[model samples]
Each structure stands twice: as structure tokens, then as C-alpha cells.
Target: MPKGEGKVLAQNRKASHDYIILDTIEAGMVLTGTEIKSVRKAKINLKDGYASIRNGEVFLQNVHISPFEQGNIFNHDPLRTRKLLLHKKQIKYLIEETKTTGVTLVPLRVYLKNGVAKVLIGLAKGKKSYDKRDALKQKDMKREIDRAMKER
Candidate 1:
């Protein structure tokens, strides 16, 4: 990775398998001091996390940032809902877009950029059972093709 492209702290790999991501947006996170320290160490889980528009603002829910071990008394709540900082226009657009049926917001990954914590949020539509199966089949086929080419 190059400079300015910070390290990824955590990712929700299952999001891609379950939803067809239509678009992605990067937003900043409001973190406490210790929480940011924990995030730097990659002590976070995005597997069960999601984003929502609440009270005209965006918030992240279910994402867990483990408490800083050294800061026993000042540790932040591991699973507290964190506010996402986005422009008013962006928030309004997401609110309108998510109103359509079958569309929702999900957190794809968390990373540190320029010493700030940011989240990559995706606008996604859920995949059906058959769609998932078809994707799995295609992936398997692609893997086989790559393997065969490697041996040649």
C-alpha cells in the first residue's frame, strides 16, 4: 500500500456475498481518544455492522471497537452506536435512495486515512438464494480456469 492510503482496520467480507453493492461512499467516524487507539491496532469487527440515517444524520451500528487494554478507566464502549460525518447533501441522497424497497446501507470496511478513521459504506440490494448459488458457481468456474492456466 502506498502512503496516504492507510491500512484497513476491519472488513465485513460477508456483505458482498449477501448483497449486490450498487455504490460506495467514504465517511469519517467520530471516535473517542481510546477508541481511535484501538482502531489503529485493528481491534474492530465490521461483520455485523451497518449504517443508518437517524435524525437527519448517519450513524454506524453494531460495529465493535475493542477497548484499549492500557486505558482501563477511560475505555470507550465497545459496541456503542457511532456517528458518521458526511455532508448534508450526501446524507440527504442516502436517505432518499434507501427509501426505495430492497435497498439498504451496509458498512463494507473500516480504515485509517491520513490519521483519521473512515468507513466505506455501500448502498446494496440483497441477493436471493439462487443468485448466491449462481455467484458461487461462477467463482468456482473462474478458479478452475485460473488453476488450469497456471499449470500450462
Candidate 2:
């Protein structure tokens, strides 16, 4: 299917408001058994999650996958860092892109695709306070226009 097509389990709504997403990449996640179970249950928190490239590899940090209820002793840590699977070329590009100031890698959403867990990571640039206000104004205008059109 198309990129990011799947049942979205969790989304970081604040990420969109805090940063301007320039591009997105879908990457598979390496999860333990219990971790996958938790993900399937939609017990995941993408807030405070970010991707970092280290030692030529990408890792997802601060994403909380709640421990499975029935996993008992087999439950994995809720906030453990998870490895992200991306091609070598993609990693290289990300490494280069993130080197720029104010640019960051933020997890936009988590979804299940074909029974596998994937994370949609966005290349984002931080929004200034004025930029945020402008965005809000634009959204309000768009909403007003849509409402007027719908009532016509």
C-alpha cells in the first residue's frame, strides 16, 4: 500500500503544533514480544519521542510502550530505547539532514502495517512563537471559510 497506510495506534499531536514537518519517513521498529503485544493493543505513547542517529544507526527514544497486561515477568521496559530499521542510504541522509541547526527528528505516529509495527518519523524544524500564532490564525480562517461554505 501507500506509505504510512495502516491502523494508526498513537500520534503525537503536539509535534505538529511545535514544529513544522518538512518530510516524513516510515521505518520499521524492533520490538520484543511483549512490546509488540502492547503496541497491538494501542497502548503506546508517542509524545516526548524522538529519533536519533548514533553509530550509523537510528534509534527511537522516549517512546513509551506500556507493558502488556498478561505478560507478567516477560513484560519489557515501558520506556526502553528501540531500534528503528531504515536503509543505509536513508540513515546517511538523515544523519546529514539532522546536522543542521533547529532541525530534529520527531515521531509523528505509530501504526501497524501488514502486522508489523512502524513509526512515522518527521523531519521537523522548530516553530517560533510568532509562527505558531500565524498558524493558528490561518487555521481559524480556514475553519470559518469551511463553515460558511457548508451552510451555503
Candidate 1 Cα outliers beyond 4 Å, as residue runs = 1-4
CA shift at 146, candidate 2, in angstroms? 1.3
Report lDDT per candidate. 0.92, 0.94
Could you list the CA RMSD of all candidates, in the order they appear? Answer: 1.7, 1.3
lDDT of residue 108 for candidate 2:
95
TM-score of each: 0.95, 0.96
lDDT score at residue 42, model 2, on the 0-100 scale: 98
Q: Give the alpha carbon lDDT tens digit for every residue of 60-84 in model 2.
A: 9999999999999998989999999
- The per-residue C-alpha lDDT of model 2 at residue 51 equals 93
Q: lDDT (0-100) at residue 64 of candidate 2?
A: 94
- Candidate 2 TM-score, true structure as reference: 0.96
Candidate 1 residue-wise lDDT, 1-152, digit = tens: 32465888888999999999998888999999999999999999998888989899999999999999998899899999999999999999999899999999999988889889989999999999999999999999999999999999
